[model samples]
Target: MKFAPSVGVKFHEDGSVRRFPGNTFICHVDPSLDLINELAWAQEQLKAMKCGFKFSYLPIESMHMTVFEGVCDQIRLAEKWTSNLALDVPLSETTDYFAKAVSNLGAHQGFEMVYDYVHNCQIGGSAIRIKPANEETKQALAHCREELRKATGISMPDFDDYHFHITLSYRVIELEEHEKAELKATTDRIAERISQSFGILKHRAVEFCTFDDMFEFKPMLTLA
Candidate 1:
């Protein structure tokens, strides 16, 4: 993991917003190389659509499993803070080197790298789903459901739970009938292949970590 300093507003489940100094790091486990190839194919499909906006795709290998945020008095201090933390380097040293290179650029510039990690991983698409019955898991899930109810002001049915997925591309906010049909067809073909690939592989856990301007990951007590 590599870390960088940042400043941003964080929205918590409690309905309060706070400003913080923070850093973000990427954690992945034996990510399938085929996934990168699939993303490239998706990017090509997106490019041909020419949805009329700057459509940038994140590199597949740089996906992040967690994002940390908190407040720092200044960017340099934050960077210095993160530099002192230890990291569990992934099997790919190239990714670690890239993380180091990006970190040296300072806080504001680092957000783009963070964005790339989140964007490529489709973290935003994750949806809430019911966990198997276990006291700890059940309690956590219940709390999350309560937060959603409060945030949306709607009492959603429990049976409606489903897996969450992140959006890979956003070309047109609203699409014409033909465009929607084309998109559906293309996505279905892509999804079929991805589903098969994932089905054959063992799943790994994704961790959540946060950092503050102090340039340290709160959970790991290290830079990355």
Candidate 2:
């Protein structure tokens, strides 16, 4: 809480190892943003390199950013999934504290996320890295993490700073030497095209959602 937070205080650069939570609850990106088209450019690069490799490209509808993921309780979630019918309360105790933290934020502000780079060196393959451009956007997510830690008494496992990114595709097959060079060239061009463009989508809410569901995953709670 003492230091400034734009992306994450732990600031792990690409290729560095950082501890990840054992479990995660994610925050979905609003579907109507213009920035998603940037993925199209990134995908095209994958296509160019697909000559000797296999890849998995994400559909436009499935993009989302994880707010915070870790341990939480399910007593309320089981109830929400059955009793509320439409609304939900997450099972995560951290989510409960985070939901309350968002309410006390005093103002509702969405963040502007700028491209850090489009790299294919991730554990999952390729991704578009992002950084929060303004204080509100940075603090909004940072504050939520702070609140969850302070209020819930849960220790964070991802202690080293983290980078924020959207998965572009996963490499299903290994690449040959020439193919790797070609892919790198493609990535360079795609990165240039998006360097100055901000994502069209604005974060609408801090949502609590179930993992691995198609586009419209079951949202346990949405704080707008």
Candidate 3:
């Protein structure tokens, strides 16, 4: 029998995950053929890892790079939620309010990003990191995020250190020491392969999407 942590907070050993309610702007990968190809390859590599730890993989079509995080039910702080809306406002209603709030912003200039790397999340998951392709792209994305901050009146605690990534899977159980090493080696290899294969992922627009869990994100509006 395997010995691993049984905390089971975000994900259960049986693979069921808790709901992570929120809405945010994301660069969905479905539109970019280049990204979609790289994504499929990366997913395959991750799934092929033979480490004993179980992983709950997300659907490929739902994969995306989050630009700016939005409100969540767990964090009810005023800074994390819109100022005008009540703290208890339903996530669906909050999503609607945010959609209209950002609808008027002029066409957001598109930007390009490149694969950075894949790493295990401190909490319990792994994601493929990404960054702007160039300085101009970085500046453009920063400007758009700033505009969103001003419009929504919600500022994340880690706004300064926000990491742009597309989540791949959540861990169903904590890994043993040897399994941790194995997982790291597997992720590093996948990162190297993806970096060599794909150059740039073209994002035409940012989509405002709401999510009930880590698996699916339903787009409510396209902010191009």
Best by lDDT: 3
Model 3: clashing residue pairs?
108-224
- Give a tens-digit lDDT track for model 2, residues 173-217: 456667678777877887888886754445666555543322234
Q: Write the per-residue lDDT of candidate 3 for residues 1-224, one digit (tens) a residue.
A: 43224234444557665666788888788644866777777777777878633777878888888888898876688877887689988888888888989999877756888878886986667888888999999999889999998888778778878888888877776677787887888888878887787678777688988887767888888886
TM-score-best of 2 and 3: 3
**Is candidate 1 or 2 superior in lDDT?**
2
- TM-scores, in order shown? 0.36, 0.64, 0.88
Return the number of clashes found in candidate 1.
20
What would you estimate as the lDDT of candidate 3? 0.78
How does model 1 fare in lDDT? 0.33
Order of candidate numbers by lDDT, starting with the best: 3, 2, 1
Q: What CA root-mean-square deviation does each model show from the true structure? A: 15.3, 10.9, 2.7
Residue 38 displacement in candidate 3 (angstroms) = 2.6
Q: Which ten residues in a row have the lowest lDDT in candidate 2?
A: 1-10
With candidate 1 superimposed using the best TM-score fit, by how many Å does residue 132's alpha carbon deviate from the native?
11
Which candidate achieves the best TM-score against the true structure?
Answer: 3
